[model samples]
Target: MRHTGADARTTLQKGFHEPVEKPKRFYKTVETTPVDGGFGVLLDGRNLRTPGGVRLVLPTAALAEEIAGEWRAQGETIEMADMHATRLANTATGAVPNSREATAGQVMDYAASDLLLYFAEEPQALVERQTEQWGAVLLRAEEEARLSFVRAAGIIHQRQPEESLERVRQIALGLDDFGLAGLAFGAALFGSSILAIAVQRSWITAEQAFELSRLDEAFQQEQWGVDAEAAERTDRLRSEAAALERWFKALRT
Candidate 1:
């Protein structure tokens, strides 16, 4: 079934009593309990599902096609080739085991049951959700940093707007995910570099580039440092960018 997760939980939750298909559940120490009539497998991610996105964790390509219709398809989806790579243990030599010694199908069914249960009740869909959120944080810091530099340049002299905006673009693309603060600092430096490029291209004067360069230097010293909570570091980044902007103003006068 193609799951859209339209009604998925807002955050990761453990409301499901069943398991989901995840590579991790194949081989981990667990304490099982017999309930109702069927076995209750002890797994968390299965019950908790994803943390943020509204997507279900699909098995990789190999697994998806392999178990397309078996009802026990999800586990069968992950080929031994893939499972071997992922480090699952105590699997059937040729198939999965339900408890001790069963055909691959039986083992596959148990695994599948857990997998489907997880998808039904989990939170976000994938790990990318976290990365994207962090990415947004970094992107915001960069935008404000660019704004400050442009303002400083205008206050110092009759700076051209098109040239400054174009410079900001180059730096924004070059930012690496060292963390939020690193991303912000990288963006500030990128802004400076873009201004330098404009200077080199005769788009802006060399003096303009030199003026922006002071802000870049300040980013390296202050905004670039790692902080304890990671996200909180963006405040420091903003402060540093502002400080550098001030320095640029002083230099201009």
Candidate 2:
């Protein structure tokens, strides 16, 4: 059986929750072709299309190859969740273009309540670690983006400067659809807009972002030992972060 771009998009939207009924691989060849915009993927001589039925054209040759590689890796059956590049490409080509403004707004929202802005007041050691790690990243975002942020000690909300948030909004608006999609994914995944931007800007690796985001959980695990469920969750998140990082790298190459 063959899969359509719409099928791929649906699988991505559902994520790993619902089990996808894998389809038998039908294409004998997966190759990259030069499209007018950049590069395109061809399977058995037919051009790949997006969920919206638009020709799937990537912005870079490297990215095209990455998506093609996913298709090439399929065995007797195709598993949509495993094709990270294709899922992201489906989003960029079909979903993101239509929701660009909404996507940018979501990123700005993440910046407003970024995880890095809050610190634990009770634990001195956690405070010191967060100050040392998250603080550094937040400071870099302010320095580089020319923005100001307010930190909170506990659950009470501290409003960031309006000027700073507007700057972040502008920064989000500046990205193209694909870039915005990547930014939104990273921000939501890491639960910190500053950390996401750090990874997006090449200031930090995906692994560092995961480590910084999981600081509280890691601290708890160290003290009380790890829960089986939490560890599994962390592993899944780590893999997704790495996949997003790979997608970003491919776009730049």
Candidate 3:
């Protein structure tokens, strides 16, 4: 779909506006306590709830502590936008459970036309660069998924194999709610399901994924000078990608 930095940045930043009336922090101590599922963050001995008003329970104590760290880091005013772990935890406990199938469907849809599958027809350098950087990731995906993907040049809309798409679907369907949230977030952030899976599996670092996802723009920037606005947008996406990587790491603990 030719998703540039601007496109993915817009997706990540969508509906992420800071509250006009920021609430002052009213809690003294931030902690985690065992809950029904795993652990829940406690603010001054009171249970913390998601924005949707659901009890914020996590699958692991480590993840719960991570969320608690966010709350502890807040200043006098709570900035929800800065609480990536808490926001993601909210999605995991609140929205993702109810929309698991729809989330998996979205992942499959992105896999159908994943950015890694597309190549530039012209500019031998860009084409070669795409092949060199993207080929290994696609190969690894095929090996792991036991399915082959169709490659397209110049964005002519080449269809990936149904079996391949189904394989990706199964991969997405197998994740727990928290993993699913990370996968869905990464897929949207990178605009490539393959890249998202690669990062989630530790096959590639988030920095590498970000670079690969923006290869086209990087090459263009190399040719025609970098744009300040575009660079700023990509910088924000880079930070968010790093935060997602940390979240995945915390999920392992």
Off by over 4 Å in 1: 1-192, 195-228
Better of 2 and 3 by TM-score: 3
Encode model 2's per-residue lDDT on 1-253: one tens digit a residue. Answer: 1221122223434656766688999999999999898999999999998767888999999999989999999999988777878887888889888888888777777777777887889689999999999888888887898867998887677778888878877877787777777887777777766777888889999889878888877888899998887777677778878988988898788
- Tens-digit lDDT track of model 1 for 1-253: 2111111111112322345554422432323334342222233323211223212222233222222222122342433222221111112111221222222222222212111112111123322332343233334334644422221111123233553344344443332111112222222232333332233223434343333333323333454765564334333333433433332222233
How well does each candidate superpose onto the true structure, as a TM-score? 0.16, 0.91, 0.93
Count residue pairs with overlapping backbones in model 2. 0
Residue-pair clashes per candidate: 15, 0, 0
Across 97-216, the per-residue lDDT of candidate 3 in tens digits comes to 999999998888888778888898979999999999899998998788675888888867778899988887888889999999999888888888899999989999888998999998
Please list all clashing residue pairs in model 2, or write none if there are none.
none
Give the local distance difference test score of model 2. 0.80
CA deviation > 4 Å runs, candidate 3 = 1-6, 16-19
| TM-score, model 2 to reference | 0.91
* Alpha-carbon local distance difference test for all models: 0.28, 0.80, 0.86
